[model samples]
Target: MQNVTIVICNYNYGRFLAKAIDSALEQDYPATQVLVIDDGSTDGSREIIESYGGRVKALYKQNGGQVSAYNDAVNMLETEFVILLDSDDLLYGHAVSNVMRVFESGNFVKVQFRLDVIDPAGKPSGTYVPHSAAPSDCGSPLRQGWLYPSPPASGNAYRTSALKKIFPVPEADINRYGADFYAIYGVALLGAVATIPESLGAYRVHRTENSGIDFANSESNDKAPKALTKRWAILRQMARARLGIELPLSFHDFSLEKAHFCSAVYQAPFTKRWRWVSRQSHSYFRSIVGNPFWSYKKKIGTLALSSLCLLPFSALSDFAVRYIANPLARRRF
Candidate 1:
């Protein structure tokens, strides 16, 4: 059996830490190794990690955010494959086994699966991430500067060799929060990715004072576009340096445009929201029309949904903003 390591990174999430660790330890695969890294938590997180004893390899480090933990985890990984589990999320008992099956069947750099969204209380939210499977052929869209649909960190498994080339990601401010973005996009640039169309894990979503869960909030919506824009630039640079492929200078993804639209609609004053939404709607129309990878059905569906934003009435525009533009609002809990 191929050795696989589950690196669960924690930072003051002691409330939800044990369940994450237990999920890793309870994987059906015997060769699975569970490594829990505590990023300088003050809330008895280290104690929770230590309780696992020899069942898990526990490493405690000063608080350095998610990417830093990823760097530390990658440095110590000796397994053939690794899954970076968020301290708050979980893996199904067969997650490793399912991922191994895909890896054995193909020459893939990364294996991505769906994630069932859960509340902090661990109740089902009746939603799954990505809303669709990742395309088998990512090269075409990637070269066109479009990032295909992918789940968050816990929903991915990476080949150690591919990860070794991708990390240690630059410990810059922009690269701090979303380590999975770098891992997923970077590995796609390296080689092929296998997609498992079933949910193999659970992604916990909760609202804290600082949580970015509220997609309708202007600040949260604004940050996504900037982050995604910067993320594409960084990935483009990596592709040139590592793969010698020069990506298009302009990046266009429906998700990024959605973020911009959401931010503008929510942030703009009432009198100006219509104008801003109209502008973003035009951008969306252009994006949908220009994307060669999208099928006519998808393009028409997207274009039709975005056109609702240009409606003169706030009620209709608000409905479009909530259901169509904001991804989080589409979820039914």
Candidate 2:
């Protein structure tokens, strides 16, 4: 059996599918199998995968969305490690090799690498995005505390046995959110995780992409308002499911920021709206109180920032950049 199984979930990204496949086929690691699962794309994506011939194992299925494709691929993996690569993304020259080398140390439950966001023209845009690597045995995956917001599974590698236990990827149940958050959270619940500092891949950001680009479209004015409602509801659900306690306003605010961003970008709700802006602001302040793990100093600072969120006057200032801010910015102000 191969040491690593690479799974690419293809949708309508015909233009970039070939490059993604080529990158997988060119992996420096030995004993690797590339599996391309096409989710019923009419955009010539299947043709691109077919052109690769024996270079990849292609599986064509109905247009069941990304989560469904991921569940299908995860079930089929027979290798020791599994990596998820989106069709529009590219792996660095030594990505597979770097991951293999790290695995040699034998100290991780899962490892997530860095991601570089690229423009439509395929030029490097000088943006270096990084996740907090998996939190090193961070306490209580279910608590109202802080944890790395789950790394992107795109360049992530998981031990086969470790992943099978969490399989089925919950495709049918997830509405707007993808699988990574649930996957990483489950991994943390299972064991320790590690982060690789080297950036081993590029995640393409363009107008055709669903998340970032769709939110900016002209007709989505009510998008923000509806998303705010959905986000709060999801957070309550997540908190209840994971920690069994309804998170206070502060935690709700912190969690809502993430969910809101996902809905706007990934779910693409229509027309930006802000009816729940005041309520969200209150939740933001309430999240900081009594939360464990966050240092008292940090909590105090967050409380002050949450105060800003509470003010009716600060909505425009905060709401304008709320969805786009990174984790630190969101918590800090």
Candidate 3:
């Protein structure tokens, strides 16, 4: 295995933080090192982190959210690959070795693996996300379309070179609010990603766990939409300034896309909803058309809806989407 740095960021998770550190320390990879950042936890986190002595390096700072902690970690890491872990989660013993086995000479910006859901007591929840195996090298982003439903942060491994290309991410709302969106999505846009087919980690579901970007968490419900908007805006800005690629998508543009896909936006305030769909319909129409991942039949249906975006038939379109399109498509969020 290559020289890798496992970065575990912690807040008030003192009880579970030790297991997370132990998991990183116990990695069988010969060249692996552990760095733990205690993000200004009021709890006894410092004592526990200090207890590790020289086995793990520790960085202590005020609680500035995950983005701040992540940015700090990246700035300090000189390793080839960085694996992020959460304080409340546990990494399988072979996670690092398995991910490194697939790291060949390629343009893979990152490697992500699935996580098994576990309760507070660490019992299995019997649910696996993405529900599909992608063990082989995925040359491009999973699909050519939009980067929706990004993989979880802790289970992924990213190359340092790839991250430097997208560093100093604009600390907009999403960067401050969502933990992994800025890095994950930015890296995905930069190059291809490889997904390990096996489950390499456990995501602890509990009330006290710092629910960074989880929408199901009670605190994250309201922050999700605003965070998503900020993420889209930053992507557009980066594409223009750094990559010189004029993006076909943006915050408002995605609003139109989501409306078409979910149909539930019709229930939103009329002027706000109408303004977005009307302005972005043309862009949305073209964006979804040439995407091979989208079926010709679905394209035809969306195109038809786009044609009527400016009209007063949004209520009907919304009805079709909320009642018919989503049910028929069976897309999981």
Task: Tell me the whole-model lDDT of each prediction, alpha carbons only.
Answer: 0.79, 0.61, 0.66
Task: Output the lDDT of residue 184, model 2.
Answer: 60
lDDT of 1 by residue, 1-333 (tens): 889999998999999999999999999999999998888899999989888889999889998878899989999999989999998999999999999999999899899999987877998777787765677677678787777778888999999998988788778876777777789888887788889989999988774221222532123655777877777777778778877889887777767777666667643356577677555467666667876556788888777766665556766666666665534556531
Name the candidate that leads on TM-score. 1
Which regions of candidate 1 are displaced past 4 Å?
Answer: 207-219, 267-274, 277-282, 290-295, 326-328, 331-333
Error of 3 at 315 (Å): 24
Q: Write the per-residue lDDT of candidate 2 for residues 121-205, one digit (tens) a residue.
A: 5666555455334455732543443445443567677877766665554444433335554456555545666678878888775
Better-scoring candidate (TM-score), 1 or 2: 1
The predictions' CA RMSDs to the true structure, in order, are: 3.0, 6.9, 6.8
Deviation (Å) of 224 in candidate 3: 1.3
Range of the 10 consecutive residues with the lowest summed lDDT in candidate 2: 210-219
Task: Give the residue spans of candidate 3 off by over 4 A.
Answer: 132-145, 172-174, 207-219, 251-333
On a 0 to 100 scale, what is the lDDT of residue 158 in model 3? 91
> Candidate 1: lDDT of 293?
53
Error of 2 at 142 (Å): 4.0
TM-score of 2: 0.71
Residue 11 lDDT in candidate 2: 82
Ranked candidates (lDDT, high to low)? 1, 3, 2
